[model samples]
Target chain A: MKGQIKNTLKGLMVDFLFWLYLFGCLYYLLHNNWGWTVRNKFILITAMFFTGLFFLIGDSLGRKSFLPTASTNRKWSHSVWGWLLVIVLIVTFLVGWNIVEVNPYKFFTKFRNAGGITSGIFDPSIVGYQLSNQSLEELKLDGVDQEILEKLSGIIGKRYNTRKVCRDDLKRILDEEEFRIYGEILLSKTEKNMTMLNQALTALAETIFLALLATIFAIPFAFILSFFAARNLMPHTFLGNSVYIIIRTIATIFRSIEAIVWAIIFSVWVGIGPFAGMLALMIHSIAALTKLYSEQIENIDHGPVEAIKATGASTIQTWIFAVIPQIISPYLAFTIYRWDINVRMATIVGFVGGGGIGLLLMQQQQLLRWHNVGLIIWLIAAVVWTMDMISAKVRTKLTSM
Target chain B: MSYLLEIRELHKIYEGGTHALKGIDLNVRKGEFLILLGLSGSGKSTLLRCINRLIETSSGEIIFDGKNVLQMKGRNLRYIRRQIGMIFQQFNLIKNLSTLTNVLTGKLGYVNTIHSLGFRRCRSDVAAAEKNLERVGLLEFRMKKTRNLSGGQQQRVAIARALMQNPRLILADEPVASLDPATADSVMRYLGELNKKDNITVVCSLHFLSLARKYGSRVVALKDGEIVFDGLPSEINEQKFKDIYGEEAEEVEIR
Candidate 1:
């Protein structure tokens, strides 16, 4: 009789708290962001009714054994606290939906426009890939006026008529001849894939060189810094400890920043080109590779180190005889892997004016030339695929050795 | 003046306050095979390591060849290490390295390391490494990696590497502990041969009394970091063995 009376008091307190929680959620959601409207008020009331029903089931049937094999004293989902949590989650989702201002109507409108723009870019870019005029002839448009072509050609002038036209000249030429080629593209016909191929090859070679040079430049510095960062190699003195800590902190800070940010910093420092991109890639690789190399150094068999030291070898000689032999293979493998990573990063860094095929990609993006963007993307994908194959082969061979 | 190596009250207290060795005093003459017998944690390893400065003594003095070993620094310390060879229970061979390279490492202490970095080591060093390999009867296995060698073979390779140091004193810390009885006998045979034929003073730790009596010219027994007996191996009867090793120890033979 006394336990029954206590249970009734607990039920009354739970009922009061549930309503208080609902009221608080509704007040927070409405007062801050969403306005106090009848629709929202009705939704909150319905949620509260369900929450209360869930708790009633928990109190009335939680202790009853439903299965002969199973013995459970309580149901977590049917409990008052669980029901309250479910209602809170639902309320949070609704509030977040309102905060994001998600409007399906605007998305549909832009979604339609996206189709039209994509189709337009696709048509021109695919046509640009065609080397022969056979496709253009099938368009059946009349030939462009020679007089108008002369006027546009004269604007480009003889001096600017080189195999690799300067950027400013190309822009001027494109502006003048864009309308001319709009029709001439339909009328003209011939094999001139060389120009486009040359441009692509140049940018791709530059990207590979950028990654290669950066990794090469970073190797020696990273190798030297790794010894300083290795805990066991560093002396136990205060000065030695400080040097280790400083190098570790600096490498971590450099590693934490993205390669693109480093590219931007270097681009400003060295003027927008591949040199800046190389510097950016090199700095980040140094920090990253040093950490890897140092860890490898730290984990090697100390038995060999002790053996070497016992031979009366100096510190440097000990490192040469014991440490270098153990780490050389791993260091080389890491370097090859880093080059693969740098190759991918080079393209992204170029978007920030670091120089590579990414520069062309950015240019095409800004000009709304999505077809050209697709072509550049394909170029980067090809490089990545080849690098994957090469790095894998090299690592396998190194491991076998 | 008769002593080649002298220890005057060497005390070693580890960082966690474990007194590993308590005021050990001993003297070793030139061209002697002295065996240190002790149970586990009896300071045999600590005493050997302290002699080489592998582990620092908390407070003590060690004099080697009329020079204060505790006060030696930099080049002086390395000079002493060059003369004192060490072998571990595990053999401590760089397992992945070729047996030849492992032997060559012993010469690293004597040579200028800068010139040895590339594939071309000093030509004479190569010849000397080959000579040491031949001395151990492992010249045919010189190109093979040490990991492929057997336990006794690996210990022999370790001996060969030590021979390259031209050490006046060799410290063997339970060198046969990891090997089987037959293999242990062979490794011990090699150490004994070096002690007898080369006239190298050896300070070695051992567990079995049979090997100690056979090879050791003198025996020193330690119990709880204190010297319990320091005399000829023949003098240690069953009573002295019971006192040094606790009364509970069962007498076990190694062969």
Candidate 2:
């Protein structure tokens, strides 16, 4: 009886930890000022609801009953169907949240009216002038003195005169008008910045293209190097050991230096452009992926190799039949994982003049346009999250087969 | 009858300065069921594996089918290995693969690397694998992963895989050490039947003396890497085995 109580307490502790982790992640998401979209609210509520439902079921079923108290049911817990259900639930929740939160409509609409007229029927500059003039009249009616209003009207009139105004005089009049309509003018500038949304989209597209190009060049090189890096495949000799050590050391050195640093170095060599970014990402990816692929190769079972060898199969044939099949799943998984990482790194590498979304983000930061910076951050997050979900699905489908 | 395998002055020295096999000489007649009996580290397994060149002998001339296999290399070595089938104590089937695939891998020597990588085995190879599995009474379990089967079933699959090789010689290194007495007897019966029916040569290393006597036509005893006794199973009386293995032989439960 005492033993049963101990087991029950242990179960409760584990449950508490799981709930704590879930809530902790949610807390961080909210604290990061990640915005209060409908998706976020749904995730928060769903997580809470599940936590409650799981505990209720556990209590009704008798904690030990839900867990595998006997060995026979342990097999059931480890079954493919059980794992599939859990994976499906998690993926459905994640993808659903991502789709709703990253609704492209909101992103595109935010910048819809920035620099261009939405309908093309009227110019924004002409509209801005009319709106400013109307706002001035409204201020006058709200008990503003006529002297101040007349001064504001004169300043605006001087700035927009058709005759060429002296540059110094125009600058002085613009400054006075800005001071008079401080809050209103600031809001109008923000709205105008939104119209230049195409710049952000172009930056995102360029970064994605660079990432894909780097991955294409890196995967093959990494695959070749992994053959020498695997310990089981290499001979038990000084030459083999030295070759493995050298390749491993070189890969480690490349991977250890951040991609951003690589980009800065490449930018100096090739001058500024996406070419420098691609080279940087390629070097880092080759290093990282070689290590990953080599580990996969080493962990493959030696049984098939022995079987092949006993059948008089050549060394190359043995590798083809025995080694390749075992490692294919891991290779696909690692490649997709690398691509996801490369996309994120490509943006960072752009900060060094390697041309991507990071370039626009830096510009916005320099301009102190926090609202525009917020929009860019959201767009980047959305793209990365979408890619992550797609890759996860692909990985699941491949490995199951 | 002409000798199918001959080993002369076989000696193996480890890098750590331990002698695994002292000077040893033996000859196996064609189509004979020979059993090497010894306790752990008595060099029975080493002697069996040495025939296929799985482990290199330090100083020896191993002549298999009139060819000095010790001096063979590249294509020649693989050609010899293909004719000599080997089974392990662990059964050593690839756990993740189905029984049919594991059996089919025996024909890897005949298939090209490209076909193997593409998983494109010839139709005949597939049929042969199925036939071998049926012989082992595991045709219905061919699609199941090897790990899902019991120990006896796995050992049967291993034997089926070996048969797929159509080998001239089958080497079993402690094939029944991991099984229960009943399973061991059944496995030995199958191996004995194969030898009698197909006239194929077999060299099995065994720890159980009674089992060796029950199935083996000839017993080769090794003590400390030296061949202490070699004769018909009936000639290997308890007194003779005692002389070779010393007082420790009494502790061995032959039953």
Best candidate, lDDT-wise?
1
lDDT of 2 at A208: 92
Kindly list the per-residue Cα lDDT of model 1 for residues A1-401, writing each as its tens digit: 88756655566455545565666677667777756655656656665675467445554222221211122244547454555557767987877777788888998777866763465444333223221335333433456555545444443222211223323443454465554455344223323333434566688899999999999999999999999999989988999999999999999999999999999999999999999999999999999999999998998888788888999988998888889888888888889999999999999999998898878778767886555566567777889999989998998887555
Query: Taking the tens digit of each residue's C-alpha lDDT, what string does model 2 give over B1-255?
Result: 999999999998878887878988999999999999876888988887788887788998899999999999988898788889888888878776799998988887666666666778789999999998998899999999888999999999989988888888999999999999999999998899889998889999987888888999999989898988999888877688786678665735635
Q: What is the TM-score of chain B alone in each candidate?
A: 0.97, 0.96
* Cα error of candidate 2 at position B202, Å: 0.9
Residue B85 of model 1, lDDT score: 91
TM-score for all models, in order of appearance? 0.77, 0.67
> What is the lDDT, from 0 to 100, of the residue A236 in candidate 1?
85
lDDT of 2 at B86: 84
The 10-residue segment of model 2 chain A with minimum total lDDT is A121-130
